[model samples]
Target chain A: MKKIVLSMVFMAIATLAMAQNATLPQNITIKALDGTSVQTSALQNDGKPMIISFWATWCKPCNRELNTIKEVYEEWQEETGVKLVAISIDDARSANRVKPHVDGNGWEYEVYLDQNQDFKRAMNVVNVPHTFVINGKGEIVWQHTSFVEGSEEELLEVVKKAAAETAE
Target chain B: MKTKQKHLPLLALLLATPFLGNAQGILGGHVTGNIQLDGQISHADSVIGAADVPEKLLMNARADILYTNGNFSAGLRFEAYQNPMLGFNSKYQGQGIANYFAAYNGDKLSVTMGNFYEQFGSGMILRAYEDRYLGVDNSLLGLNVTLRPIEGVTLKALAGKQRYYWEYGNGIVRGIDGEVNFNSIIKSMAESKFRLTMGAGFVSKYEPDQTISYTGNSAFRLKLPLNVGAGAIRADINYGNWSLQAEYAHKGQDPSIMNEFIYREGDALMLNATYSQKGFSANLQAKRVDNMSFKSVRTESGEMLYINYIPAITKQHTYAFLSMYPYATQTTGEMGLQADVMYKIKKETLLGGKYGTDIHLNGAIITGIDTNRIGGDGTLGYTSDWFKTGDLYYADASLEVAKKLSSKLKLTCTYGYQIFNPIVEGHEGNLHHNHILVGDLTWKIDKKNVLRFEAEWMGSDSKYDKNIDDKRCGDWIMGLVEYNFTSAWFVSVSDQYAYRDGVGNYYNISVGYNHGATRLQLGYGKQREGLLCIGGVCRQVPASNGLTFSLTTSF
Candidate 1:
């Protein structure tokens, strides 16, 4: 009985420390790799369509998925005019590697650093390799966790559907 | 509210546009945002629930607000954790503003003030920040400025008080850092195809420590300097198919509550090299950290108020069993090495017909650093000497292969071997043995609709430590199947079982409908027991019997 009581106390304490939110707050700053400042609003494509991939240098899946997509990114862009933005959540320890990592990988997508994870937390991303698909009007249309070998192909198909609708 | 305000600014900007609404009241600004939610209502179960804590309902939601103008920007977060789920810290049960900050940028001069987050070199000595889901917000509310006096020279200085709990912590903290980026300084170097970037940064902080009590001399109450300093220099050079990077860092005596004894300062080094070409690539990485235990508070919980962030170099798998065991960095002393290689077999070959085949192999190992302690009888040693060798701590090796098989069929197989030590993480000190095999197949039925299947098997050689574990060790198996109907609807069913020795047999079934931007998902599952991590953040998961519902909409 005494052990159960102690465990209950511990459970209460742990649950109380978790902070949850249903929607993102209204204020935050988005900075570019060169440390240049861009209005969060500037990232808007007027709801046409967009893809934001949460990644980190230390995350193997993030590296794998990003490189896999880079191989056919130009084709996706030409087909849908959709811009895929790769956001690096590499904190201070690996933040310095952001530049070289991008250059070495030869990825042509727009890159940003979220060392603080303000954006990641807002998006409720508990892990790297989380991808979000936004429609042309600026709404999160879909989100998928984790990446398999050909998940990029599935993502592109989704983009193609959105593009076909835009043409219609 | 943000979306409502967003249009007015655009409308106003469109009215101002001489050409029309395209640029006018359009108040043209780019907005990128995301939100995630996990909610559950569990039924009372003697084995999973905490008797009185109501095996009832719990939920949490976090959103990031990012607003930026021409040369300046700002962001804030609103979070709520109403009875957060099992195995999570409860202090964040209350709902309110979790984080807020702003910054301004210009040529050679950048200034930021308010509640902000920052990390020093490798976060070895100091890092302040926020993580909404796990309810962690340790931003230092103060002033910060960055000055670039020369083309390649950059300097930064900050002084602030740390945020503890709902308010600020009792301790005051201050720090200054600077770095010179060689690539930025030389325009000619930028023009060269061979990319090279070299830079160095140092950070120092002052936080009074009150726990260092001494008895030898009553008057000599070792007033902790709270003074901690670290320096790091890194270089990246790329020539042809090969690229290399190396970094070295050292920290001076700054005692935080994490490393009890004033034992000694810390030093670390990291190196990475890679080679790539058409259809093939390889990468290698190595790192070592010694005697570096720095924290903000001596008495705080083990993972809280971390002064430095230790980056782990290993692949993080997402499959249920693949992720069952993870390698968390041991900052006090550790040495690690990793290698990864990928090869693609061209089409027309036996394995690759028209699309080709992909094969990959990756391996990593970590060990403890060798050290000899020499110091005072009671107080923390002033200095300790460390050798360049140590014993193996952990290792993970894996091989994977993917084949096209046919136009309509694709298959993938993966095998992994791992060794885990319990001493560093504080659970069980026994060494762990794990072996896993995975296979996946996808059928393109038509194109608009498809079916995917995945099966995995994992076996362990280590038994649970009798001291802490109520149940013994177990072999595990997992399987997943999903069907997609059109572009907006999908359904999946997965099950994980620990039938051999442990007691984690869980089944989950979920279906989601993505109509435009609104997604609704409902799931029923028995959550297994284990540690879960997202974005370098970790939390334990308790076994539970429950139903979960999630609805997310953004415009």
Candidate 2:
């Protein structure tokens, strides 16, 4: 048990160091709302910042977070030229419900389906409502999991910081 | 000392990671993973039928590690279960590297070796996946390849054995799938509003023949097929705000225990249609499954080794009372339909008040496929017409309305009605009819503090019967309050009481803290025993009086 603990401690440090600079995984393909395959590499905002949120149709917290963000998404885009992509890990069972749910809520963010959670695994997202902010260089700058009623405010701050860093 | 020797190489590699990080110019890659630990301490509760646990504490833990460089990636998952949880399978009590895979993903060609998860269109014929909460992981261990020789076309092929607990199943499964997107390949169609994509998949399983004697006749042997196959075709079409998707699957004649060893074919069809715009949306779905239980092993049963998936067309309700009697898809033979509509009232209107009001209505009905038994065992089990319907299995309808009462407060109300047949759970009882009501109020006390309150009532016609031992029956009332503060910590308290014709009171209190990508949650509660389901798959969670905690982190 002690040796296992020692190895884990070292592994944590090594992983943290390697995690300093990370970007989205390449060559991963997911499905858009229109049933067309989309490459993750094509996710960009013309050198601007981007926000990626992992969600599911059945997750109440995820729905709340997305709904809250929908109210201010236009403003966020205008202020930072930031794009938000909502990825649904609803699997085949509820994959069909994502489009209708998103449209029902009248959300304009780009939506995709990670039916088998390949992208979710690649991104190392343990749970829904996990958000990541990417800079102009496609480098992940900030990340958070779970959301509260007012968590959107903190998310905007991170996007702004990332946008500002890209500006420099 | 021996354990240290075993991990010496791993330690050395970890010690050298810093130097490797310094060589970013050469490797230019990163490492990422997630860790989760869940522990439970439960004591016997005779009222709820919670059995005494010999092990004072049961824990399940897993760590996933991945290394990525350009188009190449590799990962492994180490899992440990000191003793399986109440709902989980005991076969998973040991610990090891449950999953590992190395892959090269390129623009046109992608290949993966070792263990991997894959799914065909709609997962009707092939779906190798995992759901930790459901304790269902059927990922295949073998080779998977995908090719995109031209734009708008994807081809995938895989061959492997299904993962059965710590060992692989005897059956070898192979499948190939292809999909084409018309809008991407044709220039004229690229800009058109009408879009179309079609996919087809074929899967086959091979297992060595096994001898089986006819019941009560030792001289007669039942001949089992050495190979069974299933195929599916799917299409997705979208025009303007209207969209439609459909998939049809068929399986060859294969005798299995789930179907009483009937030499009959199996088929399933699912169709979905939706129309939506900015403020309103409508969706309708229908599905029919007949003897479609396709498992890797002919004799294997109960939530594992399924090569095909038949999704339930029912709303996965969120409210505690509304989902008390959830529906699980019947793979042998069932038909169902669901309809959902959502509309948002304009703000400043009387019903909308200061903020817009959102209204959602959903309804679903499921029934057994009408069939006439022609013969049993070695012969065609039953015959059914496509349009005929049989006994009602489940039915539910719900309506929800959400409106903000003030800038700081929001309220939502839901009403649901359900009719469930106890036969689905292998029990014999009168149909249960329930009426449920739920009210939720969320108050944003401040920028970083929020308080939410929920109250629910369920009135059921079915009374609690000790013979059946189903805890979900009887009239029940529940209340919950949660407070989140400092944008990081939260506390929740809830209680459910069967005030009429019931035997138990379940209460729970939990506290949670989240920091960045890591979260720790602790709770003490009396849990009700029931089916914990995801999608349509379910596991029986035994009732327990316990303390539970989970910690998860990702880097």
lDDT of each: 0.63, 0.85
The TM-score values for the models, in the order shown, are 0.77, 0.94
Tens-digit lDDT track for model 1 on A36-111?
3333445655445688888876565476578668868888887788998888887654564565567545678788
Taking the tens digit of each residue's C-alpha lDDT, what string does model 2 give over B390-465?
8999999999999888878989899999999998887888999999999988899989889989999999998888
lDDT of 1 at B489: 67
Candidate 1 lDDT tens digits, B98-118: 555556655566676667777
**DockQ for all candidate structures vs. native:** 0.08, 0.48
What TM-score does each model's chain B reach against the true chain B? Answer: 0.84, 0.94
Clashing pairs in 2: none
- Model 2 DockQ vs. reference: 0.48
